[model samples]
Target: MSESKSAGEIRLIRLDRIEVLNPRDRGSRVFDEIVRNIKAIGLKKPICVTPRFDANGAEKYLLICGEGRLKAYQALGEEEIPALVVEVTDEDAFIMSLAENIARRQHHPLELLSGIRQLVDKGYTFKSIAEKTGLAQSYVKEICNLLRSGEERLIVAVERGAIPINVAVTIAGAGDNDKAVQAALQGAYESGALRGRQLVLARRVIDKRQRLGRAAGRPSTTKHSQVSTTTVIRTYQDEVKRQTALVRKAAFSQQKLLLVVGALRQLLSDENFVNLLRAESLTTMPKYLAERVWPNGSHV
Candidate 1:
């Protein structure tokens, strides 16, 4: 039954009649959340569907969005589900479905990869994908290359925020040599693409994979061993060095700041220097320097 034209009246369509156009392999947590939410509060948003007449003159609805909600309803043994019928071509429906998922802030990286791959398969170029999905062209190209090269481990690392995408790309391009992988990791560290715990985790992931002969593109079958004492000592030493460098850098900055403050204070006390600064319109000192030079609210 239809109610209004503007709001796209909600209709109870047969569950089997609606086909999910773009289904994603979401994580269990997301699936469970959907199930829980739907079970507790019922469906909040009605799934969007478009109608297509079958060969037998029977109308079937194609789902544009809400695959998770549809799945939740199915799991609840639902026969008919609420849907909003929209008039659109198949291509438009697909685009709408892609947009709906991609527009979400919490959309999974894997889903984006899959969606991009689908677009590529459907004859969409990198530029077209970027335009349609609102993703950067470089990002689309890189992810597509990763998928093409079968870099599942790197993809997983990127999805988990364990490694930057560019770093992963570098590692993936580094052949099957341990030395090359190590070199890439070093480059990433030097370029500041990786730092601290992320750098450590990346090293571990890469090293573990390399020692077991399972590179980024290769299939992973190696189980990690217990952390060795030597490894622990090495990691601790690296952390100490990093912290020491940071401390030294901070100390140097503080010394420079103190010197600057002292020089500015000395210059401000001189009548000639103060007059020169005023004449040159350079009376405005930095906030930090001003705060220190005029701590008692005295005008300089």
Candidate 2:
């Protein structure tokens, strides 16, 4: 409980004494994995906490990080857990919690958005949030705007990489007008913001959302069928384009392979080149080139 105590010293503390300052909004998949790992191998990392004196002069620790691990331990019914107590103020504890969550690579985008909103509500400026979270100001601003607009579906799609942010912005700006949305998609394609398969997929997602009446904020319990003639034609066209692209790539690769094979064949015939290869311990040919150059299994 001393302020001079170092965080490197790990101590066993009562679970009920430590408090979680900021909890992350983790999905069920993440929670289950954490529980499973903890149950299997035990806690890999100790939770960080700061000591504080309560009204009765009793020492109570405030957690700075490791909310998930704490939850897992609690779920496992563990009373005492390993904790690293650091000497920091209340503000520092909160900032550390925020930093840890934001710095995590696997943190959900929605959780990050929520944390940014919390910071904004706590009187932090956009610039401050950007600096603290190491995110660009424009990106933070855009996400904040999306949060303000209540664009939950778009947020999910963008986070999941189902659509680009620019495309989502264009679609969101188009409001309830399907014609305007289509025009915007066309403009996006022309501007090179979307290309080939991405453009096609974007169109399909928008069309599906529109047909389900979900794009305009309407709640419909009916599931719409997507087996129309137009959809069939679009699918066929996309498949053709994809196949054509694949064919072109394969042709290019084949040409390169032929060039390499020809060069290797010419080189292998040279006694000096073969001597150099022997000197360098490079006698074994690559499997692909070997199969192609020596189809009859005769050594060059």
Candidate 3:
């Protein structure tokens, strides 16, 4: 980016004039800390913003960075907050915001995963994401895998700090094998990676995950269909009738087959019939047919 995009004149911008391009949710505790810190020490740094114009050609500031600080300022009931009015494009501003987030030394696991997923959505490869976020490529790939496979339970548990990322990855790597996942959890507990409530919580999460499957937010409360019991009985009765017809047809076919087989056996028993078949070179028959025709004979 050019210097013009990096550096901008400080200006007091109205809170209403600033539009948050992309809003990221920060944890309440962290936001509280930020608010307290700023309230005590005053605003240490100015927020970054890019000038944007609305359809009415009215000047507006699109927020590029410092969302938490901006929110803190709003929480402080400040009318006009100091902002660095830059000249970067929307895409570049978004990139700068993402870069600012990735540059943080202490990112919450949920935030970290969200950042990596955002970069992946922006068409960055695993290697590129690793480089951009200063994370290992393998770790980035695993994070992406977790997102791709919709491992919502493991992800939510990780977000809530119930389990570490590595343990989650290990359990997820076990695939649908409930036994392997149980073994992994046991190992985690036995190795002191998980203790007491965490181990219990992990086990509970896994059990719920296994029984209820992955959930994004609220669990589904889909009720049974409103079909009447009488309707079900009638449908089942129809199916049974259809099946009975099939069974009757099968029995009739079997009886006819036995009659044919008896006739064939009687014919084969005749020496004159065997001689005629040998004359026509039709002496050989399928092994099944031979077995049916000559039950006691050594057809083999």
User: Against the true structure, whose lDDT is highest?
Assistant: 3
* Candidates' RMSD to native: 15.3, 17.2, 16.9
Residue clash pairs of candidate 1: none
Question: Which is superior by TM-score, 1 or 3?
Answer: 1
Better of 2 and 3 by lDDT: 3
Worst 10 residues of 1 by lDDT: 212-221
Tens-digit lDDT track of model 2 for 224-262: 645789979966876776677579779999999999888
Ranking by lDDT: 3, 1, 2
TM-score of 1: 0.61
TM-score of each: 0.61, 0.59, 0.60
Q: Which pairs of residues have clashing backbones in candidate 2?
A: none
**lDDT tens string, model 1, 188-219?**
99999999999988987775544433324322
- Give the winner by lDDT: 1 or 2: 1
CA lDDT of every candidate:
0.79, 0.77, 0.79
lDDT of 3 by residue, 23-71 (tens): 7767677889999999999889999999989999999998987898999
